[model samples]
Target: MTGDNERPAYERGTGFLLARLGSLTARSWTAFLTEHRLTQAQYTVLVALQQHGPVGQRRLAELVAMDARNIVPVLDSLAAGCLIERRPDDTDRRRRTITLTGGGNALLAAVADAAAVEQDQFLHALNATERARLNHLLRRLYDSHIPEAPQPG
Candidate 1:
């Protein structure tokens, strides 16, 4: 049996690197977005809507990798801020579609600028080529996990 001070080989290797990288990235994003009065989740939602356009709530939740129930409060707050609107889906009244309002678009533009600056500062240790490689690897990892469509609720 290993003592408390001893870690298994895997724990001290790839697992440690992955955990540290994930935590650092998450913290950097949280701090950067919070400076603009947005949580990581809100920023993610806005980015998704910006990219995909008017999307159903469930689909939005999936795109952002959030639970449907958790997404409701975020959507509610965005709607209350006049950043987005929820309208009944033309095809399915039971489903609501979310779209960014002009205000939301403007906010997203500002946030995108801030995010770019934040990313530069966050990855200052990496060169342009390294950053590009890191981004490509991360995208591949995500694509391997998340499906193209939201799983039916």
Candidate 2:
């Protein structure tokens, strides 16, 4: 085992770096999303809908790393703006499925472009390949450390 004092500050301080990165990333995304009149949570939900097709509210919440209650207001805003529609699941009247509308898809496209620029600006020192690798590593860390809710079919 390596002694705590044997590593440089940067090497020994991954937790600090991770926390800062998370905070900075959220701030960056929020700034980018604000231009689209979206919160980071709405952008996240839009992305999830684009990727997953229609999904239950809980499933969508999990996709966006939010609690079910927290996702409701975002969904309501989207619904009111005609960006998304919520309907009862065919199999269960009590379960609602969330889907992106055509408007949502168009909005997401615009937001995605902004997201790319924001990501590039945030990680300007990293090349495309390095960015990909960093995403892979972060996903691996998340998979190992955070237990996800089982996705519904």
Candidate 3:
């Protein structure tokens, strides 16, 4: 535990490195989202709704990997902001489906573009090819680790 040139064990760990990277990016992203009146959870919900179209609350929770009960608050906030609306499912009168409002789509489009720019700035140390390769590898690993439902195109 006493070497002038040796790095610590945590510093050498992949998980630790990922966590450090997440922390660095999260701070900036959180602030940026706050300026747009969004939290990460709320933004995720809006993005999922945009991608999947209208879905029931339970299904939306599954898509976002969040507990159905826990997502209620996020949904409520979005509804309060008029970013989304819950409507009675046509097929099933018992359940409500969530749909993104036009305002939500507009906000998502603007924020998504800016977010991409922010992400590029964060990964500026990596060249374009390197960034692409890294993203591919990360997506591969994530896909293998998380059993994902096929998303609709």
Candidate 4:
């Protein structure tokens, strides 16, 4: 393929749209999270815990797309607030599993409600059907790109 002014297929289609949408969605979500005294990183961790329950620190870091080293300070602050607890893993003495405390559960519930409002605010320009369509398309786009892990036999 030889062209001076031609662009790749994705540059003009789904990829470009997804990049723009992701930036807009993240910005809106971060602002909402800040109002609740949570950073985007903290909110991501909380959401993962709420969805996955107790998990090892390494696994949590992977789920939230954060470096393992950066997770410690956030965990420390949450632990100090009684929002999360760290306990020794039964099978691995050197590892600790983090779980949300009752307070953390309550706070996440409230934050989730606020997040719903924030989502509505972000999508206010679109009609209900358009919003639903956009969400469906976005999910499909992500699902197509994310590589699937092989299952152990």
Predicted model with the maximum lDDT: 3
Q: Model 1 — TM-score against the truth?
A: 0.74
Higher-ranked by TM-score: 3 or 4: 3
For every candidate in turn, the CA RMSD to the true structure comes to 6.0, 5.1, 4.1, 6.6
lDDT by residue (tens digit), candidate 1, 66-89? 999999999988998898999999
Candidate 2, residue 112: the lDDT equals 71
Candidate with more favorable, higher lDDT: 1 or 3: 3
Cα-based TM-score, every candidate: 0.74, 0.74, 0.82, 0.76
TM-score, cand. 2 vs. native: 0.74
* Residue-wise C-alpha lDDT for candidate 2, range 13-102, written one tens digit per residue: 889889878888778667777878988778788889999999999888888889899889999999998999999999999999999999
* lDDT against true structure, model 1: 0.88
> What lDDT is obtained when candidate 2 is compared to the true structure?
0.87
lDDT of each: 0.88, 0.87, 0.92, 0.85
Which pairs clash in the backbone of model 4?
none
The residue pairs found clashing in candidate 1 are none
Best-to-worst order by TM-score is 3, 4, 2, 1
* Candidate 4 off by > 4 Å: 1-22, 148-153
Cα lDDT of model 3 by residue, 27-145, tens digit: 99899999899999999999999998999999999889899999999999999999999999999988889999999999999998998998888888899999999999999989999
Worst window of 10 by summed lDDT in candidate 4? 1-10
Q: What is the lDDT of residue 20 in candidate 1?
A: 86
Best by TM-score: 3
Q: Of the candidates numbered 2 and 3, which has the greater lDDT value? A: 3
